[model samples]
Target: MTDITRKQFIKLTGAAGLALAGGVGAPALADTFLHKMVRKPIPSSGELLPVVGFGTSRVFDVGRSAEERAPLLDTLKILYDAGGSLIDTAPMYGPAEAVVGDLVARLNSRNKSFIATKVLQNGKQAGIDQMNASFHKLKTSHVDLMQVHNLVDWQTQLGTLREMKQDKKIRYLGITHYTDNGTRELVEIMKQEQLDFVQCQYAMNARLAEEELLPLARERGIAILCNRPFGRGALFNKVKGRELPVWAADLGIHSWAQYFLKYLLGHPAVTAVIPGTGRPDHARDNVMAGMSPLPDEAARKMMLDHLHGL
Candidate 1:
């Protein structure tokens, strides 16, 4: 195929299949676009969820000050309208739960979204209280998935999360660790116990997650939630002047963002990749990455080589 121009690139999206648009009175299915990676089955339950996810880490978690969160409302709407369902947030992110709570309530999209959050507390009672706060803040009856954030007080909190899952207040229970050190321990925790989802940073630039965490998740049938898909803007900067490889068309990757996102979502264990953003265009581009052909082995290797060279 010939090289796709920047303008044409902007118009043609990836072919991996994604549910990019939604219509009222008819909720979109997981397989709406056929451009994103195929939906993965939840380990504990059979419900299939899209492998692309949304995060509330940076500017998005700020609803405390009116000026700080004015744009996030629009961003969330874009996400919902585009068939995005998985929303990952935590008390670790300042005011994110609060912002999400208000917006979800106002939008009345609480049931439409799959809520995933964390417990950042010590001991069983404290963990329960924090979860209650999360529910109250998010204005939801229960969370879709609850995780122990970075193993903080894991011993004390994990048991409580397990109990909540038993009671059905939460659908899934899991643990998270961001660093490589955390990976081994998280893997051990998965080995010892049953978990539904795990959240961590992953990108073409950060292959550390691939080294062991992802493999373990795949082994346990645990869903992996990937954060920092853009490498916190570093990857974007690296590709600023670079053009998409001509062969990208074979995999349906049209832009640098889509190239990077598709590469991560292509991984087998990745249940979802949560890239943070507050802009409508960025949200659309990121969500659009969810739709189409995740490159096969050969294309992925070439993508890494080209990105490294760029």
Candidate 2:
């Protein structure tokens, strides 16, 4: 983290203290003492990214209404206030790219954010058109990262992305997939292409990535953006009536969301985990997972074992 980020965190914690004295809540107070936000370097460029980021899929595909956008605005504010910058979206997520652009514009956070959008079309021309549309919807001339969503026509789209990078329209290029079925192909592409990043699903409940995808990313020096960190909410369903283990408090984990996110963050190869949420409180809770004292390999194994028993 930068000195500016430390100052921002201190300032936010001071405000949280005031809120606590005003009887806000213990949870708010707990947030005040979290360690400095954790950041990991993008292996390709060495640019530091906060370990926790928010994703825009179903949650961000809202119409243009203050009523619909109010919570989203709060969510972005919470994310920025906690020093998080990466925001993932895609053209396939109906209206999500627009919603993110509008909200980030409203918050004046485009500069502070590392916005990542995708190309989901087939042919090269179609991919070019789709990426251009993403640039408009994201309200930015140049995107921080542009990815091939679900690897749809990955070869064609990747060629287009490389050209865009050369043209300075995108700073980095990557590919994404959400299931193990794509792991083999994803690995082959990683081996063949000089990608900067890869977004995929990874969580305690979804560990298929650990078998190959993650280690390969490490070896290839590609940053990883973990999606579906909660296994698309399947992990929560499994622990519906369960309580967090006693050791969770040692790692500053107060909620199950943080528990799950910290587990992913514990891994060395994970660059960041983008958990989707429209709720400000959930955003705040998720950002807390990026704080220090993450689980070690031993603790991660314990977490997995505990999850299995539940």
Candidate 3:
């Protein structure tokens, strides 16, 4: 399939009244189209973040060899070109942090990217040391956001994070957990500390966060970064052979990825949904969900019903 430029995409979809040919293989759309993409503000600082961002977990843990790094370069370019910037990574993810740093440096997109990494050490000094290492690996002195991964020694780590934020080593500080089991503890932490962000699992299959974590984040003015948005590819498996509902096209959803992402974006409290992908085509498909006309309450319910039936 031939990749389409932003102008070609707009002309094809707008003037020619055509849909995306295959939902992938297209490069990022143009800058003029970026303004039309959905953006939600960080409650504490009112800085707007694109509703769709990148994630580096299992997919980004690869060797520094060109064979391993080539596709990743394309993926990051597709993401940045499409107006997506926020990237979530952690020291626990092995070489993922180094890969992101190297790739971003190669692309010279450090100024354009919103880099987020985490610290999971047990002691305050250890936490500080881990974050310092993150800065070095990320090839930047100042990071956009730093999170306490899974609340590991959260109290000790948060103190370090707070100090870093004050010193301008990191712009924001928050906590993260990938399971519904951690929501209660996250809520308690939110009530006690002033946080700029909270990342938790919130997807079609995982609705537990919606019951409490999401509402309280809004109440406390904390930005939400949703992880496991695709249930680690379980949602795709569930609909492997099925076709999209006829009404999905009305919202400009061309693929199942957009279908799932749009459902999460439908909730008002969701700030951004980070779906990890190493494939550039998948990256292109993922960013398209950040556009406007996302699913509404009624549409979301319909989607839920459809998924349940599937």
Give TM per candidate: 0.85, 0.90, 0.90
Ranking by TM-score: 3, 2, 1
Per-residue lDDT, model 1, residue 218, is: 80
Candidate 2 clashing pairs, residues 3+ apart or interchain: none
The C-alpha lDDT values of all candidates are 0.74, 0.83, 0.83
Ten contiguous residues with the weakest lDDT in model 3: 15-24
Model 1 gets an lDDT of 0.74
Give the residue spans of candidate 3 off by over 4 A.
1-36
Can you write out model 3's per-residue Cα lDDT over 1-310, one digit (the tens) per residue? 3334433433333421112522343323553234435889999999999899889998899998999999899888877777788899999998999999999999999998999999999998888888899999999999999999999999988888888999999999999998767877888898889999999998899999888888898899999999989876677667654677888889877777788899999898899999987866667777878888878889899999999998
Candidate 2 contains a number of clashing pairs equal to 0
Candidate 1 residue spans exceeding 4 A from truth: 1-38, 64-70
